[model samples]
Target: MQTRTALSLVAIAALTACASQPMRAPFSQADLPAAVQVPAGHTVVMETAAAGDITYQCRAKKDMAGQFEWVFVGPDAGLKDRSGKVIGKYYGPPATWENNDGSKVTATQLAVAPNGAANIPLQLVKANPAMGMGAMQGVSYIQRVATVSGIAPASTCAKANEGANQLVRYTADYIFYKAM
Candidate 1:
């Protein structure tokens, strides 16, 4: 019993320590790939570790035009920081970002690469026009990196489960960039 208590305390202390540190820039401007270009004079302002689910709704095949018999639509999820703070959210085809402080940025996919079978495709997202005065203020671009475990479960799309909302949990690094 005492050992268990000690272990729990240690874990809490570790989480608190991690949460206290300020977020850091993900990478230097020069390091950004051409597809992830930020405006001239812009640089990475903040980077947060996002841990959350990527919700998917199974849908039936539409005319059998694609290889997969069924399709999954959505990546909607609330995002959290390393210390487990609800900092933001992500959603939609024109993927959007909304932070706790009400900052919002709608993004367009500029590039993507497969991370893993159980992870959503990592992407470079360009902000339409970063708005608000919160953690996302002045943000012009975002990169979804180090993604894991958020892939849509295609197998769940059995005909009977069509239109069902399923959530696939995932984690990733979300780097925000802004004009200096």
Candidate 2:
């Protein structure tokens, strides 16, 4: 029984170590679905898990019958690897990547899909070389995929929460690609 317990503890420790390391694997570009377009010469360099909120603020839409509605402004999330080290962050102007090494890149949307029953969309993102370095050095694109959860309540447009910030929890995979 003592030997069995020792082995179990070792197994658990190994799993924990594997779960806490940063992921720097090369992902196959071909694995990307047709919806995610890789720019010419770009290849997937790293893939991280993003767990955070899609922030919303109640605002008066220009054409929504004078009623306020929840508008998706941006994401406030932490980016982690399979090993669980925080590699970056997502926030600002619809989409952005800020790495731990002080590299930051804002992306332009190339393709998007209506994700599910929710009204929000999933996106294919591209970054500029001039915008980042270090961990994000040379990164040219990212695909937001494998989304499991994260969408704001449609009922939040009510007067009670008007002009206030709301955070909708979500999780997704962020695959980073670089120009090779």
RMSD to truth, every model:
7.9, 6.3
Q: State in Å the error of residue 136, model 1.
A: 2.3
Q: Deviation in angstroms for 135 in model 2? A: 1.6
Predicted candidate 1 versus true structure: per-residue lDDT over 98-126, tens digit per residue: 88888888877788777667777767877
Write one digit per residue (lDDT tens) for candidate 2, span 1-180: 999999999999999998987775566556555777576787767889988888788888778766887788788889998779998898877467888889887778888766676534557877766364587778788888777656766665866667888788888888888778
Candidate 2: lDDT of 180? 89
Q: Clashes per prediction?
A: 0, 1
Choose the strongest candidate by TM-score: 2
lDDT of each: 0.72, 0.78
Task: Summing lDDT over every window of 10 consecutive residues in candidate 1, give the lowest-scoring window.
Answer: 65-74
> Which ranges in model 1 have alpha carbons more than 4 Å from their true place?
1-41, 65-70, 81-85, 92-94, 154-156
